[model samples]
Each structure stands twice: as C-alpha cells, then as structure tokens.
Target: MPYITVKMLEGRTEEQKRNLVEKVTDAVSETTGAPKEKVVVFIEEMSKNHYGIAGKRVSDQ
Candidate 1:
C-alpha cells in the first residue's frame, strides 16, 4: 500500500478536494505500481493563523 499526505491551508470546496484526492491517488498508483484501492491519500488543512512564512503568520498578512 502507498500512503500520501498533502498539507495545505484551509478553505476548499468539497468538489475541489475530491478532485485533488483523485488526482493524487492516480499519480501515486501510477508511480509506485500500487493498486488504486491500495493507494491512500491524506489531506491535512490548517488555518491561516496556524501557518507561517518568512517570520510572519499567514493570518497577519
């Protein structure tokens, strides 16, 4: 089985998240020779206040 994790900022529609998971699963399966059913993709979302860049929090920008 192949496990993949995608971390990004919060705020995405259900349809978008569905598409993202589908595409990511396909890519992982194709690259690792894992069956589609055996490929796992995890989506982790964080709020702007929880994310930071260049010494500044996203929420403050």
Candidate 2:
C-alpha cells in the first residue's frame, strides 16, 4: 500500500480536487507499478494563514 499526502493552501473547487486526486493516483500507480485500487492519496488543505513564504503568511499576501 502506497500512501501519498498532498498539502496545499485551502480553496480549490470540488472538481479540481477530484481531478488532482485522480491524476496523482494515476501517476503514482504508473510509476510504482501499484494497482490503482491499492494507491492511497490524502489531501490536506490549510488556510492561507497556516502557510507562509518569505516569513510572511500567505493570507497576508
């Protein structure tokens, strides 16, 4: 069982998240030779304030 975790700033449409998971699963499966059914993906979305860049929070940008 291969587990993949994706972390990004919160605020993506449902369709976008769906497509992201599907594409990521396909890529992992293709490269690792893991069955699609056995591939696991976790989406972790955080608020802009929870993420930062250049010592500044994304929410501030």
Candidate 3:
C-alpha cells in the first residue's frame, strides 16, 4: 500500500479536495507502480492559527 499524506491549511471546498486526491492518486499509481485502489491519500488540514512561517502564524499574516 502506498500511503500519501498531504497537509495544508483548512477551508478548501470538498470538490477541490476530491480533485486533489484523484490527481495525487493518479500520479502515485503511475510513478510508484501501485494500483489505484492501493494508493491511499490522506489530507490533513490545519487551522491558520496552528500553522506558521518565519515566526508568524498564518492567521497573523
């Protein structure tokens, strides 16, 4: 099984998330030689306040 994790900020629409998973699965299956059914994609979304860059939280930007 090929497990893929994608972490990003929250608030994306369901459609966008679905599309992202589909595309990621396609790429993973093609490159890793794993079956599409075995390619697992996990999406982890975080709040802006929980993610930071350069000593500043995303929410503060």
Candidate 4:
C-alpha cells in the first residue's frame, strides 16, 4: 500500500481536491506497483493565517 499526504492552504474546491486525489493515487499506483484501492491519499488544509512564507503569513499575501 502507498500513502500520500498533501498539505496546503485551505480554500480549494471539492472538485479540485477530488481530482488531485485521483491523480495522485493513479500516479502512486503506476510508480509503486500498488493497487489503486490500496493507495491512500490524505489532504490537510490549513488556514492561511497558520501558514507562512518569506517571513509573512500566507493570509497576508
């Protein structure tokens, strides 16, 4: 089995997340020889205020 974890700022549409999971699971299955059913994908969405870049909060960008 292959497990994938994705972390990003919150606000993606449901369709976007679904597509991302589908694509990532397919890629993992293709590259790692894992069954599509055995590939687990997790998405963690955080508030922009909780994430930062270049010494500034993402919400400030």
Output the number of the lDDT-best candidate: 3
Candidate 4: misplaced stretches above 4 Å? none
lDDT of 1 at 12: 95
C-alpha lDDT (0 to 100) for residue 34 of candidate 1: 92
- Model 3, position 8, has a per-residue lDDT of 92
- Residue 6 of model 4, lDDT score: 99
Minimum summed lDDT over a 10-residue window in model 3 is located at 32-41
TM-score of each model, in listed order = 0.95, 0.96, 0.96, 0.95
Model 1 — TM-score against the truth?
A: 0.95
- Residue 12 of model 4: what lDDT? 99
User: Deviation in angstroms for 36 in model 4?
Assistant: 0.4
> How does each model score on lDDT?
0.94, 0.96, 0.98, 0.94
- Per-residue CA lDDT of model 4 for 1-61, tens digit only, reads 7789999889999999999999999999999899999999999999999999999998999
Alpha-carbon RMSD to native, per candidate: 0.6, 0.6, 0.5, 0.6
- lDDT tens string, model 1, 1-61? 8888999999998999999999999998888889999998999999999999999999999
RMSD of 2: 0.6
Q: Cα miss at 42, model 1 (Å)?
A: 0.6
Give per-residue CA lDDT, model 2, range 1-61, as digits (tens).
Answer: 8999999889999999999999999999999999999999999999998888999999999
- Number of the candidate with higher TM-score, 3 or 4: 3
Please, what are the lDDT tens digits per residue for candidate 3 over residues 1-61? 9999999999999999999999999999999899999999999999999999999999999
Q: How many backbone clashes does every candidate have?
A: 0, 0, 0, 0
Candidate 2 displacement at residue 33 in angstroms: 0.6
